[model samples]
Target: MSTPDAVPVSLAEIARIAGVGRAAVSNWRRRHDSFPIRIGGTDVSPQFSLAEVEQWLRDNGKLTDVGGREFLWPRFEALGSRDESGLAVAEAARRMRSPRTRSSHPGLSDRARDLAIEAAQLGRREGPRETFEFLLQRWLETHVRQLSTTPAQLASLMTRIALAVRLGASEGGLTVLDPACGTGHLPAAAAQEYDGEDLAVLACERDPALAALASARLGFVAEDRELRTEVATADALRADPFAGVRADIALCNPPFNERDWGYEELATDQRWAHGLPPRTEPELAWVQHLVSRLRPGGAAVVVLPPAVASRKAGRRIRGSLLRTGTLRAVVALPPGSAQPHSVSLQLWVLRAAPDNPAAASPGQDALFVDATRFARPGVREPGPDWDALGSFVLSAVETLDRPDSDPPEGTVRVPLLDLLDDEVDVTPGRYTAASAEPSGVELAASWGDLGTLLADLAGHAQHLSKLGFDAGTLQTTATVGDLVKAGALTLRAGQQPAESATPPREGAVPLLTVPDLLMDGKPSGLLCADSAHAVAQEGDVVVAGVVRAYKAWVHEGPPMALGPQLYALRVDPEKLDAHFLAGCLRAPANGRQAGTHASSSSRVDIRRLQVLRLPLDKQAAYAETFRRLRDFETLLTRTDSLGKRLVSDVSDRLAAGGLTV
Candidate 1:
């Protein structure tokens, strides 16, 4: 046992190091008798000795030197047990980050020193702060199953909302605090997004390792931007680390459903200025703690489970929070927006009641935004539409700042008196009213529009059905590859652009994403201009490469950027009709053929897509029929959309007392 200097690595990391697919790594582990033995981890995902794995790769000519981070990752993992790896990495970061104080800090193992030196060198090469951030992110990703790190997008959204609330105050500079800071994501996001140069961040975590990592990360960000940050390791609820330290803004994604959050121990703690939180409702305790830590007129945004809004156990505290005008806004987020991906969470923005002559009112209304439908579509992992979601939040906050301004749709200003009655249910949906129903005249107009759409759909269907096709006369078929080889068409796959690349700020173009194709051949992704992106020109046939349901579309509008997991087929007008090719690619038989290589997601080889090798004139005839069918589909879809809108409008009007039926 050569001291196990190499860190244990997951199969995914091994695949990356060997430049192979995860399937290839599984095959090697199963088939090769001489493969590295599993040293740790569960049987399902065993971790192997990094040194042995590297040696085996080298012996088999599969190894290539990528960088120090790859080599150093395992060593950091080997420093201690899995629980201690975070602290070890944090120690190494602290040492590498400050060269002058490196010798002063004692007790670092010889192995830790060596790893620190390597990290320092890598940092120097790739901008020390950035390198360390990347390493920290990778480490967090490796332990994501065990860690409760906030998702980057959610962190950004929370920080933005907190910033917006803070801007309403008279504070010139901000001191942002996250008492339950898991990995310092909120603090770092705050430092990055806050426009002020005079800023300070304070974060506390119960886990020592996590606290150390957060401290190191925030310290680095602060140093880079000449800001101030402090991180402490302690249970925020039990121990008041930052006692008497009132921050201008506090942002936290507190741990939810924490049963033993020092309830009995901190019963008399002064932080519970509101009614003491019931033990069953620890999120409420966190809310009160955050409010206690805020200066008068300061704001705090905390992520809590949806239960807190209406849970009977915390009704007293909820009412108190509302009556005091401390609870400012509640915004509901869609599922999979953050950790514990199964549940939909809510962002509760709290502000300390201002101590002013005009602020003596006991029951102030709070802004409630129901943004549950703002999630971007995906196969299983739906992401947030960051721009739209953030904009909605900011707009809601702006509406709150103005006393008489009406909140936007999916949002409302619920009176505290109404909220405190009976259920005291502060759920945004409970307060948000649907759009007012249309008038009788408007309903008649909608009906007329629906009838017109139906007529158009019927006409298009009739035209499509009238086209004659002889199925008995078969034509020779060829793969898309064959057609490309003969220069009949060109096939190109879109490459995902760099994450840091900025999109065009103006005249943003729609991005045709795979999810958009799977939904209904619509462009649902953010509209942005990226010069480096691949564009699908008009008349080109676009097809989804990775999918559960096959989708293909013929480009009919101005050129738009093609997203990843999609292929664009440019047809030669003299050789093939674009619509005909699109229809052929979208056929059920072609879908089955493309699904051959697909498992969970389709990995269709676009070149292998088979199409009929008909003559140009015949292809044109088929394309004309396909075009009419496409029009019929368009009309039917539009009609369905209009019908839904009409029904919703009618229902809303009826509910709002604007309509009779």
Candidate 2:
């Protein structure tokens, strides 16, 4: 609800933003009287003014790339209240709007003039549109914690779906609406997706600052791009802006679970045609309001919490929407699609006009696609594979009543009569193949895999017994750095690979990210084969060079582009065994020795890791032992996965009823 820069920043945060160390900031504070004064907090942990520090950094040339994230946008945010900041951005846009268009300019504040100057300089460097984006991107990153923003991925998904439906029925250009267009991500998505089309974007936001940002960003970015953008500074639901105009495609990712979304006052608002939403059911209200703005045959894609699908309070509204066939597909998105990353969000794809539901939708059965399984597992905040997830969802939509007749996986359709039960639970997980029992053949194969895993696991246990031997004389250990210098190994720190497209490009190479290295799965990301980065080859030692947990692997898979937060060690086979080095690196002692941070999230300095000195034959002996242990862990993981699947399949079958022996 508040801006990220609202609170004075600590020295640590200053250093972080400046991409420097705390020591550097401390030195600056001690040496330079020009350094920003401590605005708040104690001497040991003093906080400085964001605006002053940024200005000091620039004046002293401590900062470069003014448009970069190192310095955030519209310094006026740090000068006064959020509204004041909004006014400054608006004033700057107003001044700039004239010069480019030959329109008259207005008198601006000193701060607004500064902002206008910064934007103009950047605009001269990288065009006007790019300057707007650069400014916005930095602002977004700076306020990531403060804003419950509609993520680019979610915005893209919503616009793509809504626009797809609208395109089928509309001609020429289409009008897009985002009633709660926070930071204009939805409108941005629409503009970017259909840049050549004669697009009209209508946006409204509660916060004047956000509204100004939306207007300025749209104006500059959409310049010369045939975009007609209108951003209003008012609560669209409360003010009902553009209520008379029906949008062909409406996309909204409204504020969720708000107790005071005008519930007490807007009780009689005409948008509630389906039914009056309960006080606790604001998502339903958002859906109905967004739906009300849609023209005949128009489509709306709304992002909502999972509870909206089955909440008892909204049952009446849900039932009405279903009955009228206004509600179409209720897609269950993977977690991390939006702000509350932990909650698997839902997308309510709706048709505007209830009078004209798609007639060909057999039995008028509502389609449900459970795409939650596409979330990248083992990630701290797992995001779905958008390309695969979106494509699967879209494909499933195309196959309305034909349940599970194809491959991208989760899909099921339930007759409206079946769905209109006592509970009226329209959760995709409840009806899709995700919750369905696996067939007899699938179960048989699972059982077979589990059996094989167990057999291999049991057979490997004996090798561990022979690993124990009499204690030998104390031997010296060499650091990984020493080994690298001795020509026995080649250690290359990983770099961030380019973001892989969904399904990837034809020639994009497999990129092993830290997540991929930890999960021991095929690389989920991609990199250009021509990119400048080390390719992890088979038999190389791959270490997840991350904070906290210790994880290392022998790269047994095909060559892959090594991504950031990973260390790839290519050892001379005759000098050092790959498996042995990986196993030794996995040791807690090595991780502790290499760790820089004392906190739970500790960094691993691979150069400081120590490995034992041994002959080639002796190294082979240890390598074999380590290899066996790695195999055991792999088998354990696969077996556990199979065991869980078997249990889930069996339970699902029983829960569905009529379980046979």
Best by lDDT: 1
- Provide the lowest-lDDT 10-residue window in model 1: 495-504
What C-alpha RMSD separates each model from the true structure?
5.2, 5.7
Model 2, residue 196: C-alpha shift (Å): 8.1
Q: Say what the RMSD of model 2 is.
A: 5.7
lDDT of 2 by residue, 380-448 (tens): 345777888878777876564354455246777777998898878888888876545678898889888
CA displacement after TM-score superposition, residue 575 of candidate 2 (Å): 3.3
- lDDT for model 1, on a 0 to 1 scale? 0.77
Report lDDT (CA) for all predictions. Answer: 0.77, 0.75
Q: Pick the candidate with the highest TM-score.
A: 1
TM-score of each: 0.81, 0.80
